[model samples]
Target chain A: MTGAACVLGVDSGGSGLRAALGSPEGAPCAGPVRSAEPVRTGPRGIDAGHFMDLLLPLARDLLAASGGGRIAAVAVGAAGMATLGEGLRAELPGALGRELGAERVALAADAVTAYAGALGERPGAVVAAGTGLIAVGTDLAAWRRADGWGHLLGDCGSGAWIGRAGLEAAMRAHDGRRGGSPALRDRAEKVFGPAAGLPGQLYPRADRPAVLASFAPEVAACAAGDAVAGGILRDAARHVAEAAAAVCPRDAASEVALTGGLIKLGEPLLGPLRDDLAELLPHARQVPAAGDPLDGALRIAGGLAADRLLLPRDARMLSVHRSEGPSTSA
Target chain B: MTGAACVLGVDSGGSGLRAALGSPEGAPCAGPVRSAEPVRTGPRGIDAGHFMDLLLPLARDLLAASGGGRIAAVAVGAAGMATLGEGLRAELPGALGRELGAERVALAADAVTAYAGALGERPGAVVAAGTGLIAVGTDLAAWRRADGWGHLLGDCGSGAWIGRAGLEAAMRAHDGRRGGSPALRDRAEKVFGPAAGLPGQLYPRADRPAVLASFAPEVAACAAGDAVAGGILRDAARHVAEAAAAVCPRDAASEVALTGGLIKLGEPLLGPLRDDLAELLPHARQVPAAGDPLDGALRIAGGLAADRLLLPRDARMLSVHRSEGPSTSA
Candidate 1:
């Protein structure tokens, strides 16, 4: 039997997969509230078969971890599902529904949960800066997207983008082609090892996204004293701030919430981002994410209508908004 | 069996493989001498074994096309050989020697031949910007390289880099993340069909380097009328100029020659690059390539001391600058 007050919410991202069991009100009610693993997936995408293999077992573990308390409802905010064809998207929620029972399911692009997690029922914008960057916003029923074009095309203020800029600076410094901190080049070279050998080590590796993002921390770590690193951070934050500022529609709220892995690095990037945003979006506020994405997933999973989630037409939304008994049925 | 006065020069670049049969004096002597085929190679790098399979036959055909020329020597100025260890470098010339009765052969980085082709023994600097950008220069025996770093690490003013920047601008315009020409977004979308489906089509292709470089032309096409595209081209040329200027040592003769596929776009890119170099490197004069890389390769193969062609310790410099018939001995 499941706790009548609790529901299950799962969030999948480039860095890890996370799951939590929480109250209908989006609060943790039991243990194993958040479980994460070093699982690999991506913006370039993975086959549905592989994605499900990772997803199904993780859900079962969380459900079992709930100690016989049934999953009152289930919602998954999965990456890459937003871009898939309708046929491919049906597989995830369908498979999960078969296992966890039907009437308790909701699925969406991680981008939607990111916006919900930041803004809740209120309207504004959320720019998630992680290994990759994408912003989602809504002004009533109209949806807007800004810069989540993946690694190749766009992702302006993302960890990978910052990392690439930092690496380029390091190379320019080493070549003495420009005036940058020698210390920045030293730190960057240490990441890849000796003397101009970065290309050899970096290109052949399959885990390119993680490796590219791995340099992002160095930009923050050196920004304080290194001119080159500081310039890079400043430029990165400017791009992010510009993107974030553009997404705000000045509707119900004018506050923008920042989320994802890169945000955790703090000031070296964000301070500049905030300063730039203040100039570009003078009336708005840059705020922290009030709750995590799982909360937002659960909020939608409950009977809250988040039309922006845009689940495929055939995707069955099993609304289970009840607060009594360990019932899997709505 | 062979024309005593002839030599062969092959220019193997990311864009295409071009081979020419010419006199030992480095002048083209036959029809369609610079024959090229759309062969697959790489940013991933093609192996020497595969390279030879493509090379040997092409050389023999070019030799035969020249009406039975006893090649005085053969040189292939290929991309990607610069970073290879001595063992790998040995394979190209060794295979070419056995195929053609040539006594002398030379192996060097494509950058060196690029410099030789542009400046010859009259040293200065040469900035070759194609799918990739590399600036090479010479001051007596001292050689300097500025930004030949491939698509991942450097290649700052390259076709691939420009295309990537242009695509990012297009995405930004499409997303309304920045104020830009919608025309740029439309043109970019035309290249890869649909606004949202680009990342899907682009990221999965095996010929990522070629495809990325393909957009460089569009940057030029739009720059005259579009602010976004104009900014990208201006930035690209500036980087190329700085790199080129930095490589030159202000010798008695200070000139920087511009070469590569991107050069054909002409004024929009080159005009800014020239103006930027005038300010950054006042003493330098910007000029066109004296000859293509194949000519430089022929010079090296003809036993001209292209000492700038730095070979590894174990690399044998078999010199056969003889005026006689087909002879294998040096």
Candidate 2:
């Protein structure tokens, strides 16, 4: 008889992708048990085939490490998979099935796993703002989404958005259309190049984050005085709070869980966001994403097996007695 | 006797410093009116003695190039010399005298020169936003004022300020404080780096345009649907217009001239700034700067010898010739 079976959960992040495997007890059966990988999924779009190619081997390695030598179920969360739809979903499981011959594969939005990670199997909202911003939640039926319109349309409160705003401000200052902020101007130039000396070639080839994220520290630096940076943060916080409020369950007390690359930078942004949320949504509780999203995905994986999403025999076979295994973490 | 003596006007720019001999007709003389030299002043602050080093060579070159070996007059409109006061006035001429002998040197703020170039000795406000920003006007006397507070404090409507604001907005969104704008987010990541990634390592070492300038196009892209970038730009334009209004002289019918890299990037910022100015200062006339700040500086060089503070004969000769010298267009 197979021991305690486990489910694997995978999360693709900005810096890297993580995987985790766990049992019903919320205990890990195998690995998380991995680090992040940098895959450039930008406006140009990720090569779904290439992404699958990269992931299957990792999954196989994770499964081999599991004691049961098999993963009963698998769920993955990705960063820029907007157009993936069923085609991408099918490719995920099909690749895994061909590699390990696993029993079942469930594919959901990265936000779903993040939501599960934050709520730990319960219903809640997860707003991930990194290179992009997507606010997601779960109700009795389908997953609910308030925003995530891509860079051109939606995603008001995101690192990319804020960074862009800061850069624009810097440019305005540089151009004299705006006044001047020494700290901001200094910060941008320090990161990219001398404002006055930027080469025509460099402007077109300039990377987004290399130039945009450079101003983040300046924003915090100037938060004490630079009204433009401060105002941007304040306004962003209001918009984010509004987004979370939009999908938050009307009846029950909503737990708004925030995650992603931006929050880690710390204060000015955090303080204002918190204050703004409190003012905007009295009933909702604002909190930092508990652990990494991978953990949430793992919990979801465990819960799925425990809650009869998988056959009891399959669960048993995939769980327990593991030296190492496929990841279950969100 | 001396091959038709001439004056040289040197306008120090962000890309490099340009030395020119302008005729009274407002044309540059000789070959290569402008040449590449390192930008001496920026938000980060000036080089230790870079100012003197740049000015000295510029003057010597002008003398050597002039058929009128005896430069009649020397007029200089240097950027960031506002705080230098008479000390700059004294030091610049003194430095030139060391090179070509202490005959005549007419030095003034680059802002004044820009005024002459754009308004042709008329009274108006010239707002220059390059890597930094300042608003200057030509009244009966030379007027100088610092608008944007070096990218740290002021700079209401500058690129750096806008970029900083956009980044802050992203962070707020990450914290569940605000909504998200994908355009801003994608642009930030492209310009700066992945959200919350290792910022210290990711940021460029030199002062660069805010990452947001990269995404500024996105703001315009999303303006039809995105409220965040649009709102940010609208507010930025309004704020910048306010600064211009504050600096424009009350005595004359205020003609606000817009000049900067941000404006060249296209709409979002420019259109909104123009609209905001119209709303803020109905009486003020908005006009595109007739030429770049360097041109303005050249104009100042010509004017200083002819009008305003007087210069010696040789200095005046240099000015008229420099104005007619070969320019970038030539």
Highest TM-score: give the candidate number.
1
What is the Cα-based lDDT of residue A221 in candidate 2? 68
DockQ of 2: 0.06
* Candidate that would win on DockQ: 1
Error of 1 at A221 (Å): 1.1
Candidate 1 per-residue lDDT, tens place, A1-330, comes to 334545667776655667777666656554334335433444444454555666667666766766645555666676765665233354554555555553455666777777767777566678888889888766645556688887778888789888887888888887778654577688887888864788877887776666778999988899999877888889888888777777777763567878888887788988888888888777676788877777777766653222233322223212222222223334
Winning model by lDDT:
1
For residues A1-330, write the lDDT of model 2, one tens digit per residue: 155566777777566767766765445666664555644553445545666666666766766777554566666666644443434453555566555444556555667666766665455566776656777765534455665654323467676567656665665566544544566666678776766443221344446433444455566666678888787777666666666766666535567777877676567678777886677667777776876667766765665546543211112112211121223311
lDDT of 1 by residue, B40-142 (tens): 4445445666666666677767766777866666666767656652443545556665667654556556776677677776667888888889898776456
Point out where model 2 deviates above 4 Å.
A1-4, A24-27, A39-45, A84-87, A147-155, A160-207, A214-218, A221-233, A265-267, A303-330, B1-117, B127-237, B242-255, B258-330
Candidate 1 residue A196 Cα shift, in angstroms, is 1.7
For model 1 chain A, where is the 10-residue window of minimal lDDT? A313-322
Clashing residue pairs in candidate 1 (N, C-alpha, C atoms within 3 angstroms): A1-A68, A1-A69, A1-A70, A2-A69, A2-A70, B2-B70, B3-B68, B3-B69, B3-B70
* RMSD of model 2 against the true structure: 10.8
Candidate 2: docking tier: incorrect
